[model samples]
Target: MKRTLSAAALVLLAVVALPTAANALEGDSYGPGSCNSITPASVARGAAVSYSCSDFWVANQTVSITIDSSAAGVSARTLSTVADAAGDIQVSIDTAADPAGTYTLTATQGTVTDSSDFTVLDPADAAAAAASASDPSAGGNALADTGFAGTALPWVAGGLLAVGAAALGTVVVRRRQQA
Candidate 1:
């Protein structure tokens, strides 16, 4: 029993430690930079949104940052710099002149690619602004259903539940044993 417990402990320890090792090797799951996050991201249409991206790196790697708006007229600063020893590449954006909509923020470092979605809110988009503040995914469904763009997730989930119930019942046996 002691041996079995020790083995179990080792197995659990390996399971826990393996992910850490893999994560370290994989760096960040979403890759380098604030690529995984867009902080304090919303601002008035003509108002400036100053933000930065944290960096990540490997030896001899190249890093680039691009921020742009697909909404008619918008601009972003270009940052092309060699990563620091720690792979730090910081950048800022001036959203003051951009239109009101979501913009793409992409960072490329060697083989790793990361992106974050940010919104430039027009002071006039009150309904959209409110919906977005309530739920970020709501903006995409402005013409569709409520409760964000994932209003269908529950239905899909229900279907999965029904399938799961059928499978469970199939695996269970109810038979009267000879008395």
Candidate 2:
């Protein structure tokens, strides 16, 4: 039993450590940036966002950052820059001119690609906001708030009861058999 447990522990340790090793080996491709992340996932309309991406294998390679907007009035924009030594690039995007909506930003070098989503929210209206705050049911619907309204709750409760009864019956049967 001790040997078996030791073997199992070793297997578990290997399973956990393998992913970290694999991830460390997986750096940027010869074409695309490797380590990339964006800060502040959502923001007000027309705000600046910061992003960093690394292309360790492809040092000094040019990368293109493209911004695609859902709003029709605004056209997609692209910016290009070369990565620094150690394959790192840092940039800020100016959203102030973009319309309020979701935008996808993609960075590409050759065949490698990484993308992030950003949100721009519209400013709230004063009178409409005031009316909703004053009225208890103004902004939100009662039916939607309940989530599992109508017959759903009842069916869920009945299902729980059935499961409980089956578990109780199994316990009782096992006890009678032991007795």
Best by lDDT: 2
Candidate 2, 102: how far from true, in Å? Answer: 0.5
Candidate 2 displacement at residue 165 in angstroms: 31
Task: Please give, for residues 37-143, the per-residue lDDT of candidate 1 as tens digits.
Answer: 56656766666544344555653456677787677756665666566676655555666567778888777766776677888777777455666756747644345
Instruction: Supply every candidate's count of residue pairs whose N, Cα or C atoms clash at under 3 angstroms.
Output: 0, 1
- TM-score for all models, in order of appearance: 0.48, 0.53
**Model 2 misplacement above 4 A:** 1-34, 55-57, 123-179
Q: How would you encode candidate 2's per-residue C-alpha lDDT over 1-179 as one tens digit per residue? A: 45445554665575558656767655544344455566666665566787787553257889898989878887899998788887788889887787778889888888877788877665454345445656767764333345544875675576557655655665566668679
The prediction achieving the highest TM-score against the true structure is 2
Worst 10 residues of 1 by lDDT: 170-179
